[model samples]
Target: MLPRVLAIAGSDSGGGAGIQADIKTITLLGAYAATAVTAITVQNSLGVAAVHLVPPDIVAAQVRAVLTDIGADAVKIGMLGHDATIDAVADALADFAGPVVLDPVMVAKGGAFLLAPEAVGLLSARLLPMAAVVTPNVPELEALAGTQVEDEADLLLAAQELLESGARAVLAKGGHLPGDGDEVVDWLASHEGNRRFASPRMATRHTHGTGCTLASAVAAGLAKGLPLERAVAEARAYVAGALAHAPGLGAGHGPLGHGWTLASG
Candidate 1:
C-alpha cells in the first residue's frame, strides 16, 4: 500500500513552494499527497507579492475531513501566515497519530515575510511540541532561539536550544551562513543523537523551494517507515539531486527539478 501524507500549508501560485512543493516532493518519493491549504500566496520565482490567509474554521474543517477519510501516515506543515492559522493547525493535529514535519517558513525566497511576528509565540507554545521534526533555516533559528548563530558551533547550540524550546527534534539549515566554500551543512538533532548532512552547494540561484522539498521528502520517508536518521539522509540526497538538476526558470530563484527521478527512470 502507498503511504498517505498530508500537507497543511499555504498555496504558492508559482507552484514552487508551500502546498505545491509538498505535493510534488511527496509524490516524487512514491507517497500519496493530500493538502489542507491554510493560506493563498500571490508569488512567483522572483518574490511574494501578497498573502490571503484562509479562515481558521475552514482550515480545521479541511484537516478534519482529510483525517476522517484518507488519513495521513505523516504530515508536512509549512507557511502558516498568522497566529490564528497556527493555532488552528495545532488544534487540528493534536490527535494525529503520525509523524509531523514542521518547516519554519518565516520568509520567502525573495526576502518577504510569510509569518507574522506575533505568530512566533503561538508556534513555539502550541506547534513545536507536536512536531516530530522542526526544520529551520538560520534566520528562523535565530528568531526561535532569540540569539545570533554566527558559525557551525553556534548552529549546534541553536539546534539544542530549539529542542529545549519544545521541538522533539530539529534540523538547522546552514545555507544562509557566510562561507567561501561550496559546501553546506545541515544539522539534525534529536533526543537520540545528532548528525550533520553536508553537500557541495549548487551554484545556482534556482533554489526557491528547497526547504519545502526537503521537509516533505523527510515526511515521505517517515511515512514509508524509515527511521529519522535514514529519512534525513535520504531527504538530503533527494534535495541535492534536485538542486543539481534544477530546471532553469524565471528571472530570479527558480523551482527545483522535482521530476529528476522520472527522467532518470
Candidate 2:
C-alpha cells in the first residue's frame, strides 16, 4: 500500500508553496497526497496580493472525509488562517493516530500574513498537544517562543519554552541566522536532547517554498515509517537536491525542481 500524507494548508495560486508544494513533494517522494485547503491566495513567486479564507467547517469536513476514508500515515499542517480554522483543524485531528507535523506558517515569503497573530496562541494551545513535531524557521520560532533567537544558544532556550506547549519535538531552523558562513545549521530539540544538522549553503534564489517542501518531505518520510531523526535527515537532503536542481522559474524567488529527487542523484 502507498503511504498516505494528508497536508492541511492553504492553496497557492502560484503552485510554489502550500498545498501545491506539499502534494508535489509528497508525490515525488513516492507517497499519496491529500489536502484540506484553509485559504486561497492570489499569489505568485513575487508576492501575495490577496487571500480568501475557506470556512472552518468546510476545511474540517475535508479533513474528516480524507482521514476517515483513505487514511493518512502522517499529517502535515501548514497554514491556518485564523483561530477558528485552528480549532476546527485540531478538532478534526483529535482522534488521528498518526504522527502530525506542524509547520507554523505565519507569513508568506512575499510579506503576506497567512496566520493571524491572535490565532498563534490558539494553535499553541489546541494543536501543539497533538503534534509529534513542530517545524519553525527563525522567524516563526521567535514568534512562537516569544523571544529573540540570536544564535543557537538563544534558540535552544526559546525551543525550551515551546516544549512547554506539549509538542514532543521542535526543529528550530537556522536558515535566517546572521552569519557570513557558507553553511546553515538546524537544531532539533526533543525529550532525548538536541541534535544539529548542518549543510553548506547553496547560492540560489529558487527557494520560494523551501519550508513547505521540507515539512512535507518530512511528513512523507514519516508516512513511510521512518524515525524522526532519519526523517529530518532525508528531508534536509531532499531539499538540498531540489535546491541544487532548482529550475529558476519566476521573477522573484523561483520554485525548486521538486522532481529532482526522482532524477539521478
Candidate 3:
C-alpha cells in the first residue's frame, strides 16, 4: 500500500509553493498526495500579488472529507493565512492520529506576508502543539519564539523554546543567518537530542518552494515509516537535489525541479 500524506495549505497560482509544491514533492517521493486548500494566492516566482482565503468551514470540510475517506499517514501544513482557518484546521485534525509536519509559512519570497499577523498567535496556540515537527526558517523562528536570532547558538535556543512551547521537534533552519559561509546548517532539536545537517549553499535564485518542498518531503518520509532524523536527512538531500536542478523559470526566484528524480532515472 502506498503511504498517504495529506497536505493542508494554500494554492499557489504559479505552482511554485503551497499546495502545488506539496503535491509534487509528495507524489514524487512515492506517497499518495491529498490537499485541503486554505487560500488562493495570486503569485509567481517574482512575488505574491494578492490572496483570497478559503472559507474556514470549507477548509475544515475538505480535511474531514479526506481524513474520513482516503485517510493519511501524515499531514504537512502550510500558509493558513487567517485565524479562523487555523481554528478550523485545529478542530478538523483533533482526532487525526498521525505525524504532522508544520511549515510556518509567513512570508513569500517577494516580501509579501502570506500569514496574517493576528493569526500567528492562534496557530502557535492551536497547531504548534500538535505538530510532530515544525519547520521554521530564521525569520519565522524569530517571530514564533519572540526573539532575535543572530547566530547558530540563538537558532538552537529558539528551537528549544519551541520544543518547550509544544512542538515534538523543531527544525530550525539557519539559511538566512548573518554569515558569509558557503554552507547552510539546519538544526533538528527534540527533547530526545539534537543534530545538525549541513549542506553547502548552492548559489542560485531559484529556491521558491523550498520550505514547502522540505516539509512535504519529511511528511512523505514519515508516512513511509522513517524515523524523524532519517526523514529530515532525506528531505534535506531531496531539497538540495531540487535546488541544484532548478528549472529557472520567471524573473525573480524560480521554481525548483521537483521532478528531478524522474529525469535522473
Best by the lDDT measure? 3
Cα lDDT of model 3 by residue, 1-265, tens digit:
9999999999999998999999999999999999999999999987999999999999999999999999999999999998999999999999999999999999988999988888888889999999999999999999999989999999999999988888889999998999788999999999999999999999999999999999999999999999999999999999999999998899999999999999999
Worst ten in a row by lDDT for model 3: 114-123
Least lDDT summed over 10 consecutive residues: which range in candidate 2? Answer: 152-161
Whole-model Cα lDDT of every candidate shown, in order:
0.92, 0.92, 0.95
- lDDT, candidate 1, residue 234? 95
- Best model number under TM-score: 3
Residues 116-221 of candidate 1 have per-residue lDDT tens digits of 9888888989989989999999999999988898888899899999988888999999999877668998999998889988889778999989999999999999
**C-alpha displacement of 204 in model 2, angstroms?**
1.2
Q: List TM-score per model, in order.
A: 0.98, 0.98, 0.99
What is the per-residue lDDT of model 2 for residues 237-262, given as tens digits with 9 covering 90 to 100?
Answer: 99999999988889998888899866
